[model samples]
Target: MLLHRLRAPAVLLALALTALPAVAQTPMEDPLDARDARRVDRMEKVVRELRDIVFKAQRTGAPVVVQPADTDARMAELGARISDLEQSLTRINGSLETTGHELELAKRENEALKVQVKDLTDRLAVAEKAVAPPEPPEPPAEEPARAATPQEAFTAARQLMLSGDYAAAEQAFAAYVQDYPEGPRIAEARYWWGKTLTVRNAHAQAATAYIGAIRGWPQTSWAPDAVVELARSLVALKKPTDACQALAELPKRYPKAPTTVTNRAAATRTQAKCAA
Candidate 1:
């Protein structure tokens, strides 16, 4: 009986083990339900990790990683980026257009200024040519005067002496004496003019002129001419001895003058001849 109880227990343990396998073998509609539940738990864990990463990024001021769930959401994000790019491009294009327009206006103004400067330069050249002054005419050339001859000058001097223009006549006679002291007419002119000056009471000047003619024209034909006149002037000056000496030298200087020899020999015969 004890043995039968023991066998009954063993049989019951085997039957329980056997019934568990049979239940496990039976088919069910939710075959992977537990696996699905585990998969859902793993997905929940990944979501929690992503949330933590996003929180950390926020704290550090960094960008969050996000995934779009649908095409509409992705398309909307792309459209926003495209709109921002278009706005930037529009501003850049507007600035470029404004700069180009300003450059074009400057070019036009510069060209207009160039044309105006050229016109002003041309007008200035024309005005300078039109208002220019004419040159002055040159002056005519002149000829020099001729010099006078000696004979003409001598004739004019004799005429002045005869006219009693004593001062002018003295200058002319002095010039003639300087120019032609040995000429034929010089002794006669000097002797007669000295006598005329003595008669005019110019005794000293008359004596000087007579002495010059006697000393300078000693070899000329007027030697005895000046000698006789000088003797007369010395007598008038109360120089009788000097007058006698001058009278003695006349025949020696002009030996061929018979009149001079006769007059001198007669004058030397008596001291009263000086007074005569």
Candidate 2:
């Protein structure tokens, strides 16, 4: 009976030892806890004491000693693996942070480059406008057909002047003077040209045309009128003395002038404040 009790205790202790190795070899999802480790150490110490008691009861002179459970070695290996995992996670996190910072910097640089490109484009446009050539002026419109003869040209020019087409009349009369320098109506054309110039407030040019028309005091019907116009132009030019001089010659040069010419000469002299 005594041997049986001792054997029963030994068998129970052996079963506990076998079960402990199986539990230690089992894979765990989580790290070992301090409390669970302490409990396992107590269990191993109890199993060792029980084994020693069983051997003593069998009359063995030597005390049996057990090596430490594999659980401690496995726990140490699990701790190292957890530490490695933490380090890897830290490295991964650092890499992600660095990449994110680089991305932000790149984005900022890209935006700045975009702004610079736009500025350059704007400047290029302005430079192109500055250097670009101006558009050519439009061509002059077609003019009226030329008159067949000097008489026809002079008549056309006179008709233009009477019709209030002063721009056309000025061009026509100028053409008449060029085409017929010695034409019969040259003096009359010149006088009408001066009238057009005076209408446009071109007193300086009108004076020149009037002087040309009355050269040598021709006895034509327009001569006295031309002389009066010359004096009027000189008055407009602020040359009162020259105006008076022109008016003084109207009577001496053209004694047969009409009453209208005499009246105009008197008025011009008064305007010039001429010496009586």
Candidate 3:
């Protein structure tokens, strides 16, 4: 720094030396000339003080620039390199930021894809259920089967009668008659079938069935019972005369009827007001 300050004094001294020849060529110097010489002396004294300042400043550790032009060129080159490095760092930072943004976008897209896949899976499950065939219903539990024998069928029908299920008993006896005409209890089935119909206030149908039982199976034990019930059914049809006629024919049709059957016919004939 002090060496640069010394340059101004050196330039002034060179200018002063160059002007000394012109000064010597002039006439006896005027007051202006003496003033010029005094001014030159003051400039020389200032130049000397600048040299002493330069020496003192150098000892005080002030850096002196020896070659200003070369130092300026080197500093310019260093500044340019630093600026280039800063620009490169800026570009690198920008590139890094761009990459980070791209990665984030990809991550978001991946997450969205996963969500879509999950939703599709759920919908597929629901769709499968919607289109799937319904399960078949379970079969009902089977009841214990009844015996299919003639005696069993007749007994079942008689049980209905004992239980006071006249309609069911009539249906049962009719089914028995259809399935087994030569059943062991066929005669009883026909007779009881008529009795069931009569109990249900079906006198006209009962009369037809009773007559069929007596004529169809006259040799059977239930034939005489059919004849007795037939007369009773006729009385129920509001035909006392027809009932009396049926009772009178019973002795001729079934002479071998049991005492109980004969007694029952007599009681029915009395109730029906038959001619003595």
Candidate 4:
């Protein structure tokens, strides 16, 4: 509206300033001529007035320019620009929101993929273990040299018997005898073998072991004990007469035996009622 008010005056000022220059350009006249003196004076006064107007306009700012007959159109054009800018901003915001949703979905998918990959890796490890061959059970670790001497071997077998590991004791005693046929401990081994058989109620086998012990090592420390075990096994086999004969032989066979052995033999003889 201020532009409207200033436009007409600025146009009038510019027109007057330009027209004065042409009006002052009348055919060249003598400075001393009185006939055109008033015309020259009027022209000079008008020129001076126009010059003053130009100076005043220049002293102020440049004129606010407005095209003619385009007020409504210009206002409509500005309104359209503002509406377009608003629509562009709305579209940009909508696009940003959509992008945010897409990014969140991508993150969730990535996490799911990571979980799947981890599960697959774990399953693959287990599968590899299952399909792969066993480690050969570590080769049994070499099992250090068992017994350095015959005595050691015999003692080991006897310890098994004392500990009531009868099965292992039997195997161990048999192994001892086979490994050391002429060892000093062989007689003791045979005696213990007989005792072990009797305890297992294998009276027939016990009798064989006792007889073998007596025949193979009759002068050894275990002979008296072997005879006692033989009698017991024969009694268990329902041969009480054979058992009594075995007991009767113990005193004469092991005459130098300990008093305890001698007493046990005498008692066993009384139990069996052997002929004197």
Best by TM-score: 2
**TM-score: which is higher, 2 or 4?**
2
What TM-score would every model get versus the actual structure? 0.36, 0.48, 0.42, 0.42
Write candidate 2's Cα lDDT for 70-133 as tens digits.
7987998999999999999999999999999999999999999999999999999999999999
User: Quick one: ranking by lDDT, best first?
Assistant: 2, 3, 4, 1
Cα lDDT for residue 90, candidate 2: 100
Question: Candidate 1's error at 265, in angstroms?
Answer: 7.8
The segments of candidate 2 whose C-alpha lies over 4 angstroms from its true place after superposition are 1-142
Q: Write candidate 3's Cα lDDT for 149-251 as tens digits.
A: 9888888888888998776788888888888988877666778999988887888988987876777546777788888899888888889998998888878
Q: All models: lDDT?
A: 0.66, 0.85, 0.79, 0.76
As for lDDT, the candidate ahead, 1 or 2, is: 2
Better of 1 and 3 by TM-score: 3
Native-vs-model 3 lDDT? 0.79
TM-score, cand. 2: 0.48
- Winner of 1 and 3 under lDDT: 3
Ten residues in sequence with the least summed lDDT for candidate 2 = 1-10
Better of 2 and 3 by TM-score: 2
